[model samples]
Target chain A: MTDRTPGTRSSSGYSAWRLIAEELRAEIGDGRLRAGDRLPTEAALAERFSVNRHTARQATATLAEDGLVESRRGSGTYVTGEAMRLHRIGVRTRLTKSLGEKASASGNLRVLNSAVEDAPTDIARRLALDGGKAVRIETTRSAGGQQISMSTHWFDVSRLPDIATVLRRTGSVTSALRESGVDDYVRTSTVVGARHATASEVAVLDLGQGAIVLVTEGLDSLTDGTPLQHVVTRFAAQRVRLDIEHPRAD
Target chain B: MTDRTPGTRSSSGYSAWRLIAEELRAEIGDGRLRAGDRLPTEAALAERFSVNRHTARQATATLAEDGLVESRRGSGTYVTGEAMRLHRIGVRTRLTKSLGEKASASGNLRVLNSAVEDAPTDIARRLALDGGKAVRIETTRSAGGQQISMSTHWFDVSRLPDIATVLRRTGSVTSALRESGVDDYVRTSTVVGARHATASEVAVLDLGQGAIVLVTEGLDSLTDGTPLQHVVTRFAAQRVRLDIEHPRAD
Candidate 1:
């Protein structure tokens, strides 16, 4: 073990603890320390870094404050798993996934089922579609060979002249609707809920029984109050966590 | 087959759809339907409720809007599961049982470990304690027969006189701290992260290997800038979903 003596202040006059924290952070960034990996105890860490126990503890505390590690009772501090990127739900500009990047991530789409069906009565009213004129697009998406999410989107057929042809070729309802000359749409509202997965959902998402699924239904409307899309998406509960950050109005 | 006759209402009215939605909502509240139970399809439900396919669809949509059920495309609608109650991270509300019955839902504290060792260099500075004058209380808590979480709370030994006697009798760090004449404390900051469960955490919380754990560290300070308590809590990820709501100030 190295001597447990506080290091001399460097040329920059930085404290021993700050320097140690910076080194450990660099190691984590370089993929040396990974999620669930435990660092040495205070004594061992002090010896390893050639610092007193107090200085070593200070470095670790700094890491904890920055959300890099978690210290449990009786359990040594371990690296955090995945960090979630939080975004405000209502902001539209931040929603884009960079079309080029998203295309490269996964270009394959599974057309689960589609039909020229009448809008469900409630959807008809919400979309203001004629009594029996709506087209539905149901699709499932996968990423990295794992099922990511499933969505069913509804659009008024009257609004799209060639809805079927567009859906068949593009495989994206958003793109299909946009191609149909509809623009300037706003997501009016979204309702969220959680539920146990059905047998088919479990099979499609490869989830175990009793695993919860979060569902979000979003309604988009044109500038003239014409409903453009009523889309519902179901996400695998275990693999994803939804964060809705509301913007603060100053 | 249910008739496809279009209802004569051009605008809004107490449509047949609203009546059916009320019945389904009542069934859920009365426990006839439960989380994870599947509902019959539009065809079957229309036949049973004596309504058109459109009306049946409308009823289901209303439930979906209310966050009561989730409808997966090509599959079916199922009851939404109830997850954990959302709590703002820095909000200092007294933790209480779900049922509102304190005695039955109260948590039991198990003092896993305790020590009066020298403060780790970092902790000493944070707590403003001398190297040899800090006490750490490591505790695990169980609620409703389940190990809900574990916490490590540190205190300055000088401020807390006869800590062992108070801890042994009160069985609560918050209560003991209050009894020792400390007041006007506020949570200064909190750090949160997620990770896979450790072997001991899995055993204690009865969690699976892949289950996620949500860890939060909270620091509290008195009005005079004296550190009051430092607590770290780990919550079972599957059983709880963290919800944080902040008012948007535009």
Candidate 2:
């Protein structure tokens, strides 16, 4: 740790617990505090921040509520955010491959649903469709029996007519496309963000009531640059980190 | 519209309301349902899902609670997610530059806190520091008078002893570093992810009680790869999306 004063008395209007919690959160986020590390006792925290014990308790309580820390009944409070596993994205960026061995159930991908649908305007544009319907595939991927991500992929039906069935059989989008005679597709673009897990996401991903999901929208194309698939994938934020790789700069 | 059934009968053990909510969430996520769009009435939703009105009502209520949809008295339920704006990251992903003009309050950057601290191991390695203290600068970024991100940037004190004071004075990291005798830098690595907003984040970012922050850990180095700064930035997920550009595939 810094050994310097908190120096994080950054917000004037925020509550005392808030500033303390933010400081602790930053330490945890940056690895100065790791999982299983015991936090200072309430009295210690109180003296350190020049606040009352109750205020210190409130700060720890806030971290506990967010699953960032856990308060043992007798033992001291401890950090709980287990150094998030990294998910790397690059020129090829395949979910199953990028997730590596970490995303597991023994690591399996399953098709939850599939059907043909009139392309939504946005999906159609991304797939470069010309008045044709698209095959939609919904899937869930798990690691250690916990759902890691839910992906919905859309493909131009005229080009990959049996993509839905093939995906179900192959249990892999990359393989499904290859079976449909389109081998060696490349990721064209990726847009990332985050959002609160919805009610459905909570139940399906088995997340806590107010958890968050890291969302990635991607497109893959033929070597010739023809758009082949559009996918929206949401990963359990608590479990995944994204590593973006770039070529050396000038 | 799909012209087909919702096709989201994806979950087996989940309740009827959860299935309906999940299907609706996917539509909203993919832009089939956009901001300010009126959702089908409860009666319509029940008929479409083969469920009862109460089940349908529960679904809409959940969306309302998450701020994804809202009930407008007798008018009807409608989608409320505002089509997230994009934040692009590249070799030189300057927050002020990447955010363009969308991040507001006249788009000014200000120091929240600055100090000299013993460098944490992870940050020490990132900045290539050698047992020396580091200059830490904490900042919050805002747009439209709303906080967008909170960042903590660390620089090796031995190499840039005047960074903290310089950053506070210039109010711009790029300009501050230039004045510190480092005229050129390149972003060599970036790791992105998301997490639920901590108590402090909710207060400073002016987010809903249960919100998420899109996080990016970045490392910038001088032209010859001598580490310059290590920053951890957390953005309000509701307001910003990250656009990651890559070199076209082979």
Write model 2 residue lDDT over A11-79, tens digit each, in one string. Answer: 222356655765676577656789999998999988887778997888788778657799888888999
In the range B1-250, model 2's lDDT, one tens digit per residue, is 3221333333212355655665676567657789999999989998887778897887787667556798888798888854355777777766676665655322367788888998778788777777888999999876555566888899988888888888777777888888989888888888998765765677677765335678899898888988889998888877788888777777
Chain B, candidate 2: TM-score: 0.75
Model 1 chain A, poorest ten-residue lDDT window? A91-100
Model 1 alpha-carbon drift over 4 Å, by segment = A1-250, B1-88, B97-107, B119-125, B130-133, B161-165, B223-225, B245-250
Best by DockQ: 2
lDDT of 1 by residue, A38-148 (tens): 977989878777778897898788677556688988999998764222212342312324222333332544566667778767788888886858878777765445455
- Cα error, residue A58 of model 2, in Å, equals 13
Model 1 chain B is weakest, by summed lDDT over 10 consecutive residues, at: B1-10
Best by lDDT: 2
After superposition, the stretches of candidate 2 with alpha carbons farther than 4 Å from their true spots are: A1-32, A39-83, A102-107, B1-32, B38-83, B102-107
Q: Please provide TM-scores, in order, for all candidate models, with all chains considered together.
A: 0.41, 0.75
- lDDT for model 2 comes to 0.75
